[model samples]
Target chain A: MTTPRRRSQQDLSVHKRQVENLQRRLLLKEMLSLGALGMLAGCDLQDGDAVDKVLWTMSRWNDRVQAKLFSRTRLAPTYEASRITRPFPFNAFYPEYDAPDIDGAAFRLQLSGKIDDKRAWTLADLRALPQSGQITRHICIEGWSAIGEWRGVAFRTFLERIGADMTARYVGFKCADKYYSSLDMETAMHPQTLLALDFGADPLPAEYGFPLKLRVPTKLGFKNPKHIAEIFVTNDYPGGYWEDQGYNWFSGV
Target chain B: MPVHPLPIRVFHWLNAFAMTCMATSGWAIYNASPLFGFTFPAWATLGGWLGGAVAWHFAAMWLLAGNGLFYLAYGLASGHFRRRFLPLSPSGIMTDLLAALKFRLPHEAGTYNAVQRLLYILVLLLGVLAVASGLAIWKPVQLWWLSAAFGDFATARYVHFLAMAGIVGFVAVHLILVVLVPRSLLPMLTGRHSSSHEVSS
Candidate 1:
């Protein structure tokens, strides 16, 4: 082959400089691609339904996968007392001040859906049930977690006592704060699932879903509803406040 | 032989699509509870809100994970990884680093240089980590052992973030390299007819 024309030293450096400049524009192109991405997402939202349907379908599939993964034998990790998040975070969509001030004496937990006992239970009645406690992590979908101590009656013990159908598919709560969530039967029957009435040696404070709250260490924090007004057991899927708004229904950890 | 096989091309493009959704939606998720001092800009993020972003993040997660596993299985079954990314060493990387710094490196089709090999290995491992760390975060309670291996639920978040950052950095460099060697893009797209990586120099 004939010899190719060789570049002068100056020409080579200048070519390198040109390459560097091209790389800068390439980064700019990547940013432009990001803009294209935003536009695609925007179209998916405005054009509607078709994409939403696919996403929701996949989400439902994931819920089933999560439900399958959940085990009644495995327990959420427990922490030492010293490791508890001091001044446990009061998290709710509503502000802390707006927390409902229910009359503890008059507050009664209402029961419904496949339960033989339709009568409500007072705070004392719940506390009188077999009480248990745990210092475990409460994971949030927002990507944060905190450890706290909660004491309450085992949900299974209470469920059995109230003659709830152990074979029921879902146990849902309607909270006084207008927040609602549901748990699969397997999770509801997990060893760590509690109907919490106390927080760290004190009676569960009003700010933290007092008189009654569901402490589910295995799932995200939102699945644990506070100031619970009604408990229902059923095979029908009872979607939650956030879950209805697009959060995963299973919300398992 | 095609420099990029059908399986490899499929994996590459699918990863491109999935990573786009994951990164953009992942940013939206990260913006929900920022680990750092600042957050990603809303305009740059994919999902409109936390819930929307989470749905996108999770939906794309399956794609990325499944695509990644497919790629891994293909690479192992085909012996493509050994042929393309082997013989990497610190000394080889150092030489390539010096040459790269001086703009003396050359691009050849169907072959990887030391630096490219190192980066590919790192990014592949990071991909595995991104998935593993995501699982650790997603199932800290159920996958308690996995979570504890990374220290805890919170630490898993950090690990997941680092994997994303590493992959992002790799993509920037990979894109820039593609720009520098535009010819390389065609094969990855259409599996152009060329000598495979097994060819002698």
Candidate 2:
């Protein structure tokens, strides 16, 4: 009986050691994976072929993901006359069109990736869509707040017109003003959000994403892309300019 | 000699100074963008004035953090720190605390009296929490790892604000104690308190 009991105790000890070893290995594996991701993110610093290919690959994947996701969601909601807010705050940096390259006729918004029809939509084409309006609060990450009335077309309707594929998962926007931003499909389709053309019944001010901009009410103002030039739908996560610099990609209020 | 030595006198005073600045500047910032219904309008900065308050607060934070790191390193190397202040048995601490509360100093009170020991430890821990939460709310992106400790950006802000309030309360009490016992203040200021020795003698 003593021999049997001793043998069982030793077996239990061995089992405990095995479990501990496996746990340690799992933790190390996770750490290694994070290190790899960080390395990939930092790889942009080194120049030439390998880096360019990786960025291009990532950008292509990002475009496909964006379209599929936004189609599933609805556009920003419109507000009634009574709900219209006064003194709409415009917090974007003044004189937004610093880049000399933004000419209205020459400025074409390219819509491609994960679509049956890849086409360039002139400014007039976007204006033809059914428009929406909403009065919502713009929350800044810097602990400031403002309210504005925005007018834009339903982003979902735009996706539908383009015949976005089911495989696409996100709505990635590339701004003409060198501003790069992206959003998940769920947020892109939120009923209170918009791809705004007008602010408070007026054309979008240059400082506040003039010509075209995004309005995601539930998120901090930084997530709202301004001066949109390209709309690509993608199945993978697209990196935002701020996100690459360590800002919260979610930016949820 | 301790594995973790007591912080340098300059560091102690500088830390105290920076903490005071942060408390005052933080209050200024809070008055402008108040989360609570409560408002301190008199303390509120008008318009861009709040921006200056933020700058000063952040500058003071850098000073406090730099000094704190130096102190931590010194303590770890010098063997000055133990599990508890006063280095007495728990029962002894209880008795000493009771005596100090009653304004009756115990005969066996160490470098830090029972009251001083508890307050000091609390202040140290609160300082750490304040820094962590500040980083969380300030550059949540740059310091994402720190934000993880406090949950999210807004939640981290709440914790940071609460910790600042605690530090402010502690400062008020600390000031009152200093006034009540000038001898204690003298030691902190001059590093050799004549009055403290007189009392012990």
Candidate 3:
């Protein structure tokens, strides 16, 4: 135990050092590029490939800063029923017509990783749990926003019911449409985060994540995984489809 | 003829580049989920992808904010605001506007006309508004007060968009004026002007 603790401490120090080094390097690169601008007239340093890496580093740094500043007590603004956007636009990797057609009767939510209960939960099991609803804005990263009413069980409640390890670093989801996403445990436990089973007053439609969707209003649209299949709690970083392609993993509004 | 100060020129050019990048990338980002009933073509924007546009927008946002803060500080410390942009009488602005409309305004080398001064000041204020509204939209939860001040996130976005339009209009007129008086570009470029080009103030 002592050896493991010492190694973990060393690893943490190394990680901290790496972050500091990256920040210092980014700053130095910015200054060097600015200086070079005057010496090399009309030479655009921003066009360089290294600039992309620097920007990504800066973006990651921004993510860390945002995460540190995030407040669990602060909630996303809720709206009145009248304020909800009608025909809340369908958005996904595929067209609305291509939405996954899952058999609700046969559907089972698989739970794994750091959980005392590894049983598959049926729709009835989820429906039997306590329910909550919120009329909140869905802010898309694409710059559009729509307000919708989401009714579901509080994610923390569901996690607790399933005996998920709340101390885990991440809670990841796999979806029926090959979509996957993970949330920081802090966000996962936020009061407003829900495992949504219904939209507005009706049961969730196929086009709107029939079986289940993770409604995380504080995050951008894509962070809310739809048609959730498997949920896992782990310390391992579970990168999402868009996240792997350079979207900030912690894409909070 | 008095040329623009070195710091002013540097700030001006840097601001120009930053705004161009910000606006173009902003358009691209907007195109992802367009407003005002139409979308800008992908070919017209700086970054092809929404992700790329977002990256560019953020990168340029830092440049614009940093340079603008520096410019504001220098303007304050050096009394540039008072000397060049203030003490404008309503009558003088009206006179300048009439003269400009009638195409009879004199091009003074060392000073700005009242109309020019007012427009410049307006554009500067709009730039600040753009940044503030942008911050509100960018981090509505983090900067809750700013978003609240604008009523909501939707309102803040509208304000940001309007500010961008205002700045774009100002730039359009500014470019036209520069083209009409091409000599004005020289002092801004090299921080110096030939004595022959100087007109009596």
TM-score of B chain for each model? 0.93, 0.82, 0.95
All models, DockQ values? 0.39, 0.03, 0.12
Q: State the lDDT of candidate 1 residue by residue for A1-253, as single tens digits.
A: 2233354556656765674565556556656876766675652222357777777888899999998999898988898999999778889998899999999999989999999988999998887888989999988889878899999999999999999998989999999988888999999999899999999999989898977999999899999999999999999999999998788899888
Docking class of 1: acceptable
lDDT of 3 by residue, A55-101 (tens): 57766776787799788888888888999999899999999999999
Worst 10 residues of 1 chain A by lDDT: A1-10
- Stretches > 4 Å off in candidate 1: A1-36, A43-48, B193-201
User: Model 3: what TM-score for its first chain?
Assistant: 0.81
Off by over 4 Å in 3: A1-48, B196-201
Better of 1 and 3 by DockQ: 1
lDDT of 2 by residue, A125-236 (tens): 7788889887765656556555577888866677778887644667788887677878776666666667788887787867677788888865667788888989888987
**Of the true interface contacts, what fraction does each candidate have?**
0.60, 0.02, 0.29
lDDT for residue A253 in candidate 3, whole number 0-100? 73
Q: Rate the local accuracy (lDDT) of all candidates.
A: 0.86, 0.63, 0.83
- The candidate maximizing TM-score is 1
Q: What does candidate 1's lDDT look like per residue over B26-79, in tens digits? A: 888898899999899888777687877888888999899889888998898899
DockQ for candidate 2, please give it. 0.03
lDDT of 2 by residue, B1-201 (tens): 321123556786788667755776576667756778875553322112343344446456767998999887776675455543646556766877777667777322126665666777788888899998987766443354676679756577789888887888898897666545443443343444232122321
lDDT of candidate 1 at residue A162, scale 0 to 100: 95
Ranking by TM-score: 1, 3, 2
